[model samples]
Target: MASAPGNNLPVFYNDLIPLSSVDHAGYRSRTLDSAPFLATHHAVPLTVDEFVSAQRFLPIIFSAGDEPVPLALMGLNEGVNTFVDDQGKLRGPSYVPAYVRRYPWMLAKLRPDSDELSLCFDPTSEALGAFEDGQALFEDGKPSDLIQGVLKFCEDFEQAAGRTGQFMKDLKDLDLLMDGEVAIQVPGNEQPFVYRGFRMVNEEKLRDMRGDQLRKISQNGMLPLIYAHLFSLQLMRELFEAQVTQGKGPVSVTPAPEPAQA
Candidate 1:
C-alpha cells in the first residue's frame, strides 16, 4: 500500500492506493464514531485559504525548512493533540482544518513522472470498506454521486494547496521568515516551558522593508495572511495551558526547550 519509495507520506495516512471502481466496487464509506488517526498528531498542514478561519482557533506557524509549509499548531509538544481526546473526538466546536476533513482520501500522482493525479485513499483507514449500512462508493461499475463529490472536494483541495505553495515561495523570496520560539511560564512553575524548531514571520524585517515591498505584499493580499500568522502566535500559551489542564503537559518545567515538530 506504500507509494513509490523515498516519498514521505502525509500525516494520518499510513499507506495510499488508488481508489477505483474495479478494485473497490463494493466498498462503502462508513462514518466512524471517532478519528483515531488524529489522536496524537499536533501539527496539521493548512492551505492559504484557511489561514483566516484556522488562525481564530489554532496558532498558525510555518514548518522549519527551506520549503516550509504552513501548519496549524494543535499542541505545544509533539505527539500531543490537546483539542482531541485519546478517543479522537473533538472536545467542542472549532474550525476543523480541511487537511483533517480530507483524511483517508486525497488526490495523488500515481506515477512519479506523471502530472496527472488519481483519487487515492489510505487503505489502513476503516472509513472505506464493504459495509452493509453505509453509502456506496460506486454504482453500476462507475463512481457513485458520493464518490464524484469526494473527487470534486479533493480537486479543490489540490488547487488550494497550489496557492499555499506559491504563498510560501513568496515569503521565502522576501526573506521574511525567521526561526520561531515561544516561552510560557505557568503560575506555579518557576521555569518556563520553551517551544522551538518552527518558523514564523520576522516582524522586524517586515518593518524594515522599503515602501514598495510593503505595498506589493499589501496589494497582493499577503499582508493579511502574515498578520494572521503573527496574531495566532498568542494562542501558543493558551494551547500549553490547555495541555496542563488536561494533565498532558511536560513532566517537569525546565530551562531547556523541547523540539516542536516540523
Candidate 2:
C-alpha cells in the first residue's frame, strides 16, 4: 500500500465477482429458475470477487539483477461507501493515476489472446463497474483511507484466496518476490525444458536479446505454454482481489470442468 519515492504505482485488483454460470452447469437435466447464474462465493475472509479485483495489475519492479520483477497487488476503493470522521468529508482524485488508467491496455499488449483479459474486461460483467464504484465510495475519504481500505482488503485476501489453490499459487509467487526472487522463465537450449527462477543474475540481459540470441537460448522452449496459463490465472485472480477488498462485488467462477466429448 505504500508508494515509492519516484511515484511508481503498484497494481490493485478490481471489484467484480465471477458468475457461477460461467463454470457450473450439468448437461444432463437439472431444472433452472433462470439462465444459470454465477455465484458470488468467497472463502468467507474475502469473496472471490474481492480477491480477483485486488490483483489485476502486475507491478514492474527492478530485481537485484535489474530485471523487471513483476509485482502484483490488489485493493483500491475507487467507489467505496467511505467512512467520514469529521475533517469536513475527505475526497478528491483517485489513487490510480491518469496515465496508469491505461493499465488494462498495457496488460492487453502483454497477451492479447489471453482469456484472462477477456474475462476481466467483460463489459457485461461487473469488473470495471465495481472499480468505478469503489472510486466513488471514498469520494469523501482521505487518500490514505483509500489505500488503507485496499490494504485491509488484501490482508483479508491473504486469509481467503491465499488458502485456495489458484490464490495460493499467486501468494507463493508473491512470497518469492518478497524473498527477493524474480519469477522468470528461461528458454532451454538443446532440450525442451523451462526454467523458472526466483533468483538469477543477468536475468534482464537474457530477457533483452535479439531474436537469434533468444532463439538460441530457447531452442527447447524453456518457457512452456503452461507457464502462461499459470501466470494468467494467478495474475487475473490477483487483479480481481484488488477490487473486492475495497468492497466491490461480483467475481467469475469457472464452471466445473466439462467431461471429454468421447
Top candidate, metric lDDT? 1
- In model 1, what is the error at residue 104, expressed in angstroms? 0.7
TM-score of each: 0.91, 0.18
Best by TM-score: 1
Q: Model 2: per-residue lDDT, tens digit, 43-139?
A: 1112222222322333212112222222121111222211111221212221222212222111111243442321122223222233322333222
In candidate 1, what residue range of length 10 has the lowest lDDT sum? 253-262
Model 1: lDDT of residue 66 = 65
Q: Which residue ranges in model 2 land beyond 4 Å of their true spot?
A: 11-151, 154-190, 199-262
TM-score of 1: 0.91
Which segments of candidate 1 are over 4 A away from where they belong?
1-7, 251-262
Residue-level lDDT tens digits of model 1 in 2-100: 133224777677788889788899999988877877878888888899999988889998887667888888877667888889999998877788888
